[model samples]
Target: MEKEFNQFIEKITLTTKQKDEAKTKYTGVCKKVHDYYYDCNYDGSTKFLFGSYKLKTNIRPITKDQDVDVLIKLPQETFEKFNNYQSNGQSALLEEVKSILKEKYTTTDKIKSWGKVILLQFEDSTHNIELLPAFEQDDNSFKIPNTENGGSWEVFNPRAQIDAFNESNKNSDGLTRKICKMVKKWRNFTTSVSIKSCSIQDWAIDFLASNKVDQLEIEEILQKYFEFIRSKCSSDNKSYVETVLKRIEKAINYIDDGEENEASQEFRKIFGNEFPLVEDSSKTNSFDNNIFSTPRPWLEN
Candidate 1:
């Protein structure tokens, strides 16, 4: 079971080819943005990679909306120019950035200004990039535009968030990232669970930090995770949480009963196709009274 779970993690991770392609594409986009602002005395060196890609928690078998996030720090003069606007300065800033990108991606019709970022969607969904134009503050935090709700500038500290996650993951011996990636797989597999990716990471980090579980005990960690997150689910999503808990319980029971293949199948149902299926070595169905006898005291009624 441990070996299968480890293989599943490897399967879901982005391949070397995928990483190289994504880096090449986003780097080109970054260069274009830098060139556009270079004549204005902009240093062209403030771009940064953030989100799941930077955190090394991104998954493979990419979906259309799966994208890399890039922060491009605009010149301070540009910030002053937009800040001086009487109203909707954030919207104006977004529009300006979108127009700049449009010049380079002339044929790509999906290049548009989203709520807080300019979404540069490519024909190959795996190569899509979310470009965040930001103004550097005195304290090193970034001020990004939010065009929604009459437009406003929001302080974003991706650096701090990334650092915290790295620290937690290190302390947990990489269990934090493993659990986060697994939860993301669950989110992708089911439509009923509508939790955000960031929220999933937060939950995993919090769970691992508060509990002391053996790093090698992946199954036990997952069992505890599902039990822990049930109460954290909102009223609207409680039923979905119950569904996951039941499936995990059944899988654990199968493992306890020495039904490795059956256990793998049950886990596949939760995490989707990336989870490898175990080979059925024995067809004998031996009825045992001790099946499902293992106590799961954490499961609530």
Candidate 2:
């Protein structure tokens, strides 16, 4: 069982590395666009890479193929055309870049096909890229104002959140206490738990930055989550246990949504006969059992 868990941890960790590499590829692309935008316009500028990669490595290892995010201010837009909450200038700009690169870029023998992606090589050697354009805010962050559908690219810098995540990781000597906080942050980054494809740092940032999980709650959740992480480490069930913990997190959420029986059912799936209960348990030892084994009465009851 220990061996299996260890394998799980290793496997998940590997998945994170792969995802990180993909995001890095895109980061490279963003760097090129930022430079190209400036060189063509003869204006000085910088495009910021904002995503999981900015956080501490251990805090947000990539789990899937989520794109690396980039934010910047376009140089040519008129004041009437762009502001913090609005901008449609980028799509036209992207096409111009594509055309210019296609005409001027020289492809090497290894290159079967090439375009603007070639220019992005300036950012990183490994190439995974996604293009998002935004206007700058007074806060040194970019804003993508929302449309009626709430699908606006609108976002703010995760700098403060990243600081919080770094502090937690540093204080704990590399352990992270922002489990829920991390998940909350990632969700804002257009990631979902079912995908497990985002950098952990992104999630931690969202958690730290959003009002969803405050500091005290973050600490409290981590205290329990740590036990789960350690229990997996001790039992040698690291990966599957991690999976199970994820299930437990979801189950608790179900309970929060008024789905108590559904939550218990979810917990039972992971725990089998060792399933625990809180209805008749001692108060002093409330946090002791495996989170999955027992119905967290504070929640379930």
Instruction: Kindly list the per-residue Cα lDDT of model 1 for residues 1-301, writing each as its tens digit.
Output: 8899999999999999999998887887787887777665434377789888888888877887678989998888888898889898989988888888888787744788869988888876676899999988888799988888888889999888888899999998888899988888888888677887787888888887789897536888887887788888788777877888888889888888988899899998999878989876474333233455656788958
TM-score of each: 0.88, 0.42
What is the lDDT of every predicted structure here?
0.83, 0.43
Candidates' RMSD to native: 9.6, 15.2
lDDT of 2 at 73: 55
- On residues 253-274, what C-alpha lDDT tens digit does candidate 2 reach at each position? 7656755556555644543322
Tell me model 2's lDDT, rounded to 2 decimals: 0.43
Per-residue lDDT value at 183 in model 2? 36
Minimal lDDT window, size 10, model 1: 283-292
RMSD, candidate 2, Å? 15.2
Give stretches of model 1 more than 4 Å off: 39-44, 283-301
Q: What C-alpha lDDT does candidate 1 achieve relative to the native structure?
A: 0.83
Ten contiguous residues minimizing lDDT sum, candidate 2: 109-118
Q: Which stretches of candidate 2 lie over 4 Å from their true place?
A: 1-24, 40-45, 56-64, 76-127, 145-155, 177-223, 226-301
Question: 58, model 2: CA deviation in Å?
Answer: 8.1
